[model samples]
Target: MKIEVNVKKRYFFALLGILLVLGGVFAVYAYNSNPPNPRVFGHTINEVDGITCNSGQAVTRTAAGWSCVNIASSGGSTPVNPVNTLSYFEDFIDRGDTSEVNHPGIISFQGYAGKTFGYIHSKDMFDITFLVKGNGTLYGLSSYESFYVGLVDASVSSRIYFFISGGNWQAGTRNGGSTKVTNLNTGVSIGNSPEWFKLRIKRVDAGTIEFFINDASVGTINSNVPVMPMQIFAATPGEADGRLHVLIDYIDLKITNLAR
Candidate 1:
């Protein structure tokens, strides 16, 4: 009886030892599976602090540090490359000019003071078109009494333009305080006739400009192209006699390529 009791007690202690070993192994596994600073998606939880991702951006860790990267939109659509093309058209229906007269698809400027209408742009590639005409005499007037259309810098010092003065039309460019002028010489005098004509200026490549009138190529300028940002403008200098009446049907501009 004594020998059987001792054997039973030894069996009970062995079973307890086996249970204790298994419990210790399970505890070690639990700690390894769920660490204090666990990794999520290959990044530690502490690494994502203070990182803000805006719309269309994702948080990423790089060798340089954490950054917000621009990603494709969330709609599962493929990302598209940016195309640099811009267009603007104004028909003069409501141009917000107090002195302008809005006549069916036309705007007339007839004031004694100088007037200017324009848009500013930094692009070097562009196409500008406008339809313009004069109502009164265009010759034998003061030198200041002229109309101009083209591009000009903010200081009005450098420009490339189509100029109408004293019954003649010319292509003119001013750079670095020096001026170069070329007459279109279309052989048609534009004196006082209320005839409308289209003028187009195009810059297809660097350092070259093309001029057209009524869809006919008039001239090409290869030198003195304004390198700075310019404003596409239509302007008339102040006339003391107040005879500078100009009408414009529309003005349009297209920026073709802006990759540079």
Candidate 2:
């Protein structure tokens, strides 16, 4: 009887010890899996930008004329990224704005606070086509993308297009074998150098669209509504002409549904 009692106690202690160890492990995993949210960097913003670049330093051709700009954010539940550079006169391209970027870099400004952009990446297919200029590296399409919200009052419309290689190899577009832009999905073409280029994304009536480079229609998209892709982005893939310099101007977005 004494031996039996001792054996039972030992088994209970061993089981309890194992359970405690597992619990600790689970706690650690939970903590590690969930990273903390991003906190505001500081009390004030101190970054320069080229948000609304001048019309023609590098843009000799109409299709290559693009004014680039840097982006910013507000800590007080403020809007960042998806900036309405043309809509709000305050957002301008500094002509001297460069910064680091990554996926999900944009947070919704006009929407309710806490609205953030997710990786609405394109599939291996489902793309529009575009053209490239100058000999340089042309990176792959971004499965992830951006979209702009056009506030319309009872449904207004605009024409949109895209050009990948005119403004100093600073644009991206997607296309299939056809040079037609509408058939492509995404394209990001550029070279690593200080060059000026032109690109146009014209959205027409929320349906017919065109992508132009240097005033030439390189591609077009025919859908029920315009793409109005809110974000323009690229990832550095391993390649030859290894270095690249890319830029994106503004998409001429027209609104029909206005609150006023």
Best by TM-score: 1
lDDT of 2 by residue, 1-260 (tens): 99999999999999999999999999999977733432221011111122212211111112343223333443332333342321211122222223322211112121121111111112111122212212123432221122222111111232122323332222222232224223343343434433333444454333445555556565555643323322222222222222222222222222222111
Residue 164 error, candidate 1, Å: 2.2
What TM-score fits each model?
Answer: 0.51, 0.27
lDDT per model, in order? 0.53, 0.30
Model 2, stretches more than 4 Å misplaced?
Answer: 1-194, 224-242, 249-260
Q: Give model 1's TM-score versus the native structure.
A: 0.51
Q: Pick the candidate with the highest lDDT.
A: 1
What C-alpha RMSD separates each model from the true structure?
26.6, 20.2
Candidate 1 whole-model C-alpha lDDT, 0 to 1: 0.53
* Cα error of candidate 2 at position 228, Å: 7.9
Ten residues in a row with the worst lDDT in model 2?
Answer: 41-50
Q: Give the range where candidate 1 is weakest over 10 consecutive residues by summed lDDT.
A: 79-88
